[model samples]
Target: MVQKYQSPVRVYKFPFEMVMAAYEKRFPTCPLIPVFLGSEVLSESASADGSTHVIERSCKLSVDAPRLLKKIAGVECVFFIQKNTLSWRDRTLLIEAHNETFASRVTVLETCSYSVHPDNESWTCFEQCASLDIKSFFGFENTVEKIAMKQYTANIKRGKEVIEYYLSELMSEGITEIPRWVPPAERSSPSKAASPPAAPSSEMPAAALAHQSPRLQMVSWGPDKLDADYIERYLGRLTPMQESCLIQLRGWLQETHKVKIPKDEHILRFLRARDFHIEKAKEMLCQSLTWRKQFQVDYILETWKPPSGLEEYYAGGWHHHDREGRPLYVLRLGQMDTKGLVKALGEEALLRQVLSINEEGQKRCEENTKIFGRPITSWTCLVDLEGLNMRHLWRPGVKALLRIIEVVEANYPETLGRLLIVRAPRVFPVLWTLVSPFINENTRQKFLVYSGNNYQGSGGLIDYIDKEIIPDFLGGDCLCQVPEGGQVPKSYYLTEELENLDHIRLWAETIYQSAQVSKGAPHEIMIEIVESSSVITWDFDILKGDMVFNIFHSKRTPQAVKREVSSSVPAVNNEQLIDRSWVLGVDYSIVESPLTCREGESIQGSHITRWPGIYILQWRACGPTHARVDEVLSSLQGSAPKCKVMYYTEVLASHDFRGSMTSLESCHSRFSQISVTTTSSSQSQDGSLISR
Candidate 1:
C-alpha cells in the first residue's frame, strides 16, 4: 500500500520576494536540518528577460532509521533529485523532488510551492504534498512504510519553522527586505544613475511594522475567509492530496453547481468518507445534493415545527460538549414510547423532527468550531437505553426508525462522530439486530454499546465525556434537561377527521399517486423485477371504500396490447391474460393471497422475490352487502362502487438493505361506515405454493 501526506497551507507575514530570498539561504547545507547533508546544482537556466529561473540539483540526505534495518539495506545516505522553477514576475516558486536511492524497491515523490497570498499581496503562502510507494522491502514493508510517513510528516512540520528561522537570521542582520526584481526597460535610467546610495537607519524589522512606538491595531484575520493562516488556525490539518481533492471538488462545484454548492467542510467529509477518492466523493456528493433539492431538506430547520406532545415526551435534547469539543445530544430511547410518538405524530412529522435536529446539529457545529477554536463538524450522541423493552420494537415503530435512518445516512453522511449507548438492556440486542442492517457500516462502527454499570468505569462514557456534565440520573453532578421518554396519552391523538387531513396533505405535496379501482375491472400495477431475492415494499391507504389487494408473478413477458383510449382514465390493458394461449400454471401464478383492507385502515408490507420475473399488484373494490341476487344487482347498477388508494412502492437490492433498515412503507387511512370482503376464488396448488 502507498502512503501519502498533505500539509495545510502556512502563511508568512512578509513579501514573497523576501521569503524567496530566505528560502534560498537554506540550500548548500542547513545546520538546523541535520538530515539535509547538502545539495549540488546539476543544471540551471534563466528566461531571456530574467523573469523566470529553473534549477535542478542532486541532493543527498542521511536516512534516519534503526541501525539493524540500515545494515540490512546496506545504506546510510539516500540521494534525491530536486527541481525548482521560479517565476520572479509572478512571485511564485514551485519545487518537485523524488528519491533516487530506492528507485527499484521504493519510490517517494514530493512537491511544494510558495506564492503570494491571493488577498494580501505582501504575505506569502506555502503548501506541500508527498507520497511513498514501496513494492518490496525485504519482509519489512510495514516498518519501512511507517518510518517513511513519520519522516515525511516531521519534515513538513519543520519546513515552516526552517523558513522562519532563516527570516529571523536575516532580520537580526538588518536584511529585513529584498527589492523586487525590475526589468531594465522599466527602470528610470537617468534617475537611477543620478540617485545616491543612502545610509542604513537603525529601524525595527518589518515584522514590527504593524505596531507603533506604543502600539497600534493588531493584524487579525477576518472570519469570512479561509486563507492559509485561517485553515491552519481553525480547520484541522489536511494532507496535500486531501487538500487537492478539496480544491478540485470545490472548483468543480463552482463551475457546475454555482448557486447550491455545499460548504467546504461538507465537501471535506465526503472526501474523507471515500478516503479522498475524488470521483467517488464527487458522485456521492452530487447524489446528496440532488436528494436535498428534491426533498427540500435545506430549509427543514426553518420550516419544520414539532407537534406540542413531542416536546414533552421526545426524551432528547442538546447537552454540553464532549471531550473532543463535539456537540453532545442525549436521547433517552428507553424512556420514550416509540409507538406512542408515531401514533400521535405521523411518520412525516417524526421524520421532519429528525431532519431539523440534524440541521440544528450542523449549526451548532459551526458555533462550536469558533468557541472551541477548532473544526468540529460532527456531533456525539449518547443514547440511554435503560428502559428499552419489546414495545420499542413494534414493527411499525421499527419501520419508521429505519426510514429515518436511510434518509439521514443518505443526506447527512459523516455527521455523527460517535454514538454512546448506555445501559443497553437485553432487549436492545433484538432491536439492534433488526435496524443495524439498515445503518451504514461506517456509522455502525461509531456505536459503543454498554450493558449496565460498565459504562461508569474505564473505557466507557468518561473516556469521551466529562463527568461534570454527565446527567444526575447517570451518577454525575449535573441535572439534565432532556425529557424522560414516557407513554404519550392516547387522548392527545387528533380525531380521525384531523388525522385524515394530515394524510391528505402528504399526498397533495408529494409525487405519490392515487388511483380509483372500480368493480369487475381491477387496478393492477406491473413492476419488472430483474433480480431475485430483492425486496418489494408497498404502502397504501383506502381513502374511500374497502378494497382487496393481491400480488401475482409471471415469467412470460406481456406484449403491448393497445385499446381504445379512455377519455376518463388511462391504464395498461392486460386483457390478454385471459387468452386461451396463456397458461396460468406455466406462465403466471398468484404470489400472495387476496387480502381485504377496510376503508380508513392503513397497510404497509414487504415481499421477498423468489424468482426473477414481472410482478403485478392489483386492487379491487368489494362491498360486503352481496347477500342475494337482488342486492348484487342493485349495488352493480347504483354507482359502480369504487375504491380510492394512495400508495408508494420501492425495490431495494438485498446487499444495500443487509444490516441496514430497508426502505419503510407506511400509510394513513380513515374508513367510513362501509364493510368489505375479497371475492373468493378456486385455490390453485401453484398459487398456494407461490404464496408460501
Candidate 2:
C-alpha cells in the first residue's frame, strides 16, 4: 500500500520574498533539524531578467532506523534529489524532491510550494504533499515504510519551527525585509542588480515586529484550505498527521459534495471519533450526512418546536456551563415518567424531542466556545435518578429509548464530553443493561456514575461542575429549573389505533427511499420527463451487496407495479417498474453506461436527457454474467444474494439544471447514444429481468 500525506497551509506573516530568503537558509545545513546533514548544489540557472531562478541539489540525510534493519539494508545515509523552481514574477516557489537510494524498490516523492496568501498580500502560505510507495524491501517492507513515514512526519512538524527560527535570526540581525526582484531595465543602481535581492532593514517598530509572528493573527484562506493557526484556535491542537487526515477528508467532501458540507468543527469531530483513520471516518461522516439530509436534521433547530406536553414533561433541558466551559445539561430521568411520555406522545414524538435536545446542545456548544474563548466542541450531561422505579422498565418505553440512542450514537459521535449520573438507584443498572449495548464504546467511556449522596462528596460532581452552578436537585445551593416530571394522566394516553398511525406517519417523513434487490429482482423507479434537455439527477448509497445502476428511457409508459410492503421492514420499497416482457432496444433504451456500485459507497450523478420520455432508474443485484442454468436454479434454491439501496432522485428543467446540479455534475457522466450497440449483452441473459 502506498502512503500519502498532505499538510495544511502554514502561514508566515511575512512577504513572499522574505519567506523565500529564510527557506534558502535551510539548504547548506541547519542544526535545528539534525537529520538534515547537508546539501550540494548540482546545477543553477537564472533568466536574463533575473525574475526566474532554478536550482537542483543532492541532499544527504541520516536514516533513523533499527540497527538490525539498517545492517540488512547496508546503508547509513539516504540521498535525495531536490529541484527548486523559483518564479519571482509570479511570487511562487515550487520544490520537488525524490529519493535516490533504493529507487527501484522504494519510491518517495515530495512536493512543496510557497506563495502569497490569497487574502493577505504580505503573508506567505506554505503547503506540502508527499507519497511513499514501497514495492519490495528485502522482506522488511512494512518496517521500512513505517520508519520512513515516521521520520517524514517528524520532519514536517519541524519545518515551520525551522522557518520561524530563521525568520527570528533575520529579525535579530536587523534585516526585516527583502527587496522584490525587478526587471533589468527598471533597475537604475548597481546595488539593485543582484539576481536574488539582498535583505534590507525596514526599521520596523517593535509593536509592528511583534505582529510578524504567525500565531499573532488567524488567516482565512476560505473553505478550500485550512490554516494551521485557525485549526489550533478553533478545533484544538492536532498532530501533523491528524491535520493531514482532516485536510484530505475535507478536500474530498468539498470535491464530492459541493454544497451543504458540514462545518470544519463538525468534520473534525468525526475524524477524532475514528482515531484519524481517513477512510473509516469518511464512511461514517458520509452516512451521517446522508441521514441528516434525509431527515432534514440540519434545519431541525429552527423547524422543531417542542409540544407543550413535552416541554413540561420531557425532564431534560440545558443548564449552565461546566468547569471546562462545555455546555451543561440536566436530565431528571428519575422524576420524569418515561412510560407516560411514550404513551402520551408516541415513540416518534419522543424521538423528535430527544433529537431537538441534541441539536440544541450543539448550538449551545458553538455559543459557549465563543464565550469561553476556546474549542468547546462537546457538552456535559448530568442525569439525576433519585425517583427511579420498575415502572420505567416498560418494554415499549425502553424500545423507544434504544432507538433514540442508536440515532444519536450514529449521528452525534464525540459530541458528549462527559455524562455524569448521580443518585443512581438499583434499577439504574437494569436500565443501563438494557441500553448500554447500543451505545458506542467511545461514548461509554465518558460515563461517570455516583450512587446516592456520593455525588456531593469531594471527588464527585464538584470536580467537573462549579459549586455555584450545580443544580439544587443534586444537593447544590443553586436552584434547578429543569422539569420535575411526574406520572402523566391516563386521559392523555394516545389510543392504540391513533398511536400506530402517528408512528407510521413520522417514520415515513424522510425524503430518501430504500429498496431491496435480490437475484433476478431489480428495484427501479420511473420519472416522466416531458421536456428534452432536462437533467435527471440521482443520489444513492449501496447499503449491502454489490449492484449495478443504470438509466433507461422509453417513449411508452411501463405498467405500474404495486409496492410489496414487507411487515418486517416497512421502510423498504420492493417495487419493479420495468416490465419483464419489454425488450431492451425495442421498448426501452439505455441512456447512460451501467455503473457497478459497491457496499458503503455513496454515488451521485446526473444525466442530461436528449429526448423527452419516461426515464427509469434501475438497481439490479450484481452476479456472474455467464453462470449455467442449473447453477442459477441451485443458487435460487439456496440463499440468493441481496443488495439494499437508499436513493433520492430529482428532475430539473433546462433553465434550472445548471444552477441546481453542481454537486452531481462531477460524478459519472458517460452519456451513451441511444443506439443498439450501446446495450450490454448481459441484459438479455437469464436472471436479468425482474423475477415474478
Clashes of 2: 0
1-692 in candidate 1: lDDT tens per residue?
A: 43444445678999987787677677566776787776777888878867788878777777778898889989888777778888877888887776677677776666677889887999999866555667677888777766665555445556678789988988999987677767757777846632211211111111111000111112112123245555545557775446556766666665444445788888888888788887788777876765565456887787667879999889999999899999999999999988888888777778888988999998899899999888898999999998899988899789889999998987788899999999999998799999999988999999999997999978998999998998888888899999887889998776767665754664245444666655554556777887765667776656667788777787777652223344544442322122235566687776776677766444556665666778877776784311233332333334665567766777766566563322221111121111121112111111111110
lDDT of 2 at 163: 81
Please identify model 1 stretches exceeding 4 Å from their true place. Answer: 1-8, 30-90, 94-112, 127-158, 172-174, 182-228, 453-468, 472-479, 491-692
Model 1 Cα RMSD, Å? 20.0
* Residue 324 displacement in candidate 2 (angstroms): 1.4
- Model 2 lDDT per residue over 356-425, tens place: 8888888898888888888899999999888999999999989988999999888888999999999999
Error of 1 at 523 (Å): 26
